[model samples]
Target: MEERKARTVCCIGDVHGYISKLQSLWSNLESCIPRLDFDSALIIFLGDYCDRGPDTRLVIDFLVSLPFRYPRQKHVFLSGNHDFAFAAFLGAIPQPQDGSEFREGWKEYEMSEEREGWYREEGYQGMHLQGRRWAGKITVRFNTIKGTEYQGSIYDAEPTFKSYGVPHGSSDLLRAVPEEHKKFLTDLVWVHEEDNVCIETSDGVKTGRLIAVHAGLQKGKKVEEQLSSLKAKDTRIPKVEALSGRKSVWDIPEELTEPPTIVVSGHHGKLHIDGLRLIIDEGGGLENNPVAAIILPGLKIVRDTDPLVKQ
Candidate 1:
């Protein structure tokens, strides 16, 4: 019989469209996977795949194509605020066009690559997914106008995807997402349905302890310990609240307002807060926001440049 190999799940946090940073992290991952001889693996790519960086579409394409290369593992996508916006843009919802413009505004990363046989002007690349594409591929030419901004062009008339959330607009993104990734966003972004704190032993059980979440749970408030007190889904950390029955991360006022649970989220680049939380957005990529992920190879929870690696 073939050897039964153990599996590992790497729960990654916000990537923010940093292609270079992702490359560097992947370089490191190459060694981590084999050295341990771990079985199968899953990369939970916490979302916000676009914006604030250079190669937005490149990142999206790369993530979408992951399963092709590694048929043995799964690449899960979690919806962050930005990704949700991009999804809305794709569906033609009337949100801000700045994000769409930003994409339409830039050139593709491969545009400059010598491999491409064409030499089109950087300004030539067209909009994708309804004006959503890459920032690096083109430049933002801002022109303010009284009638409709940007020399009355209907394109600039729209606003960038609002950083903030709107009901119908936000949901649109989730609605039209690719089939496989749809559940990841729904599972994370929407509210949960939990009455008491419940710790679900992932299929492997070991991955459960990793407690990989887009944002860490309240500090000192181990999901295992505070399972019962968790009232809503929004504030609860990813895993604990996932199994719990809550509506959305927005549902829990206690977690969001006052006693906000300590989180290990990637939003705050250099996590600045109180309580027993740790920030894993370790300033990844050069000139790019850091890319952070937790590698649970066996019983250890490992991270990039993280002193928290279990000994």
Candidate 2:
């Protein structure tokens, strides 16, 4: 059998709409990795591309432009919870399976609709759960574990709206995001699988499987069941645990007994690395922190501030 060449897989954590920082990070990544490896790298952006920061529109534009500029590199875009809401606000979320109406799932979350400020604007009767949550208003102020203060709502999507020249709850938001960008948001994947990647162990280099979701997989749920729901792009469920649930997705599923798949994610807002589970969102969409990424095989970490750092 022909030997499989060693390749690099780059996983980027939550971007949160910082154009300059993202650009800087990209420059650093390009500078650090060899040209051939950089060109052929499998780059997976772990989601949360919009919100919090001041350049959501520009960030999306840059993301959408990746394929054209780096044609040889493979890119996988995952859907972050905030990005899901942004899509919902723009009516770009994936449709329910089987062509069923989205409203069928509304009753489950209806109680919090008022609190979350589900869309009261025109054409809201046809909205989906994410659409409602994305457009909903709330009085809650969120303070992160690191003491970052987020005022107004959970998703903190106001900056995204403003980046596109609209207010947080304006109906004009649907018209604000460009058609290509809306398509970009709608096309985001819920999960990605990479087979036969190499990982370095204490003893030796070994082949491994990798599954990347925006958030970690639920601890107790059947792995197939979770993957089924995610692959189906089911929106009827009130919350997609893979996208937003924190504690639920923190651990690897116990039933994944054989083959030893590596589960990686972002959206937890904290960096965690334990054996096969990697959470890489160091920036956590915070203004002061640097966005981060993890290089495969060697498990090297690169940040927006210290891009050349490697193992």
Models 1 onward score TM values of 0.44, 0.93
- The reply for model 2, stretches above 4 Å from the true place, is 1-4, 141-152, 307-311
lDDT of 1: 0.39
Report the alpha-carbon TM-score of model 2 versus the true structure: 0.93
- lDDT by residue (174-210, candidate 1, tens digit) is 2434554433333433211111111112333211122
lDDT of 2 by residue, 1-311 (tens): 11255678899999999998898888888878899999999999999999889999999999999999999999999999998878876778767767777788788877877666666786677777777777667655555554655533556777887999988877898887789999998999989888877666675566667899999788777899889888877877657889998888898887754767778899988888887788999998889988988888778888889836442
Which residue ranges in model 1 land beyond 4 Å of their true spot?
1-6, 35-39, 92-264, 271-279, 284-289, 297-311
TM-score of the candidate numbered 1? 0.44
lDDT of the candidates, in the order given:
0.39, 0.83
Candidate 2: residue 301 Cα off by (Å): 0.5
Report the lDDT of model 1 for residue 71: 73
Q: At residue 280, what lDDT does model 2 achieve?
A: 94
* lDDT score of residue 215 within candidate 1: 37
- The TM-score leader among the candidates is 2
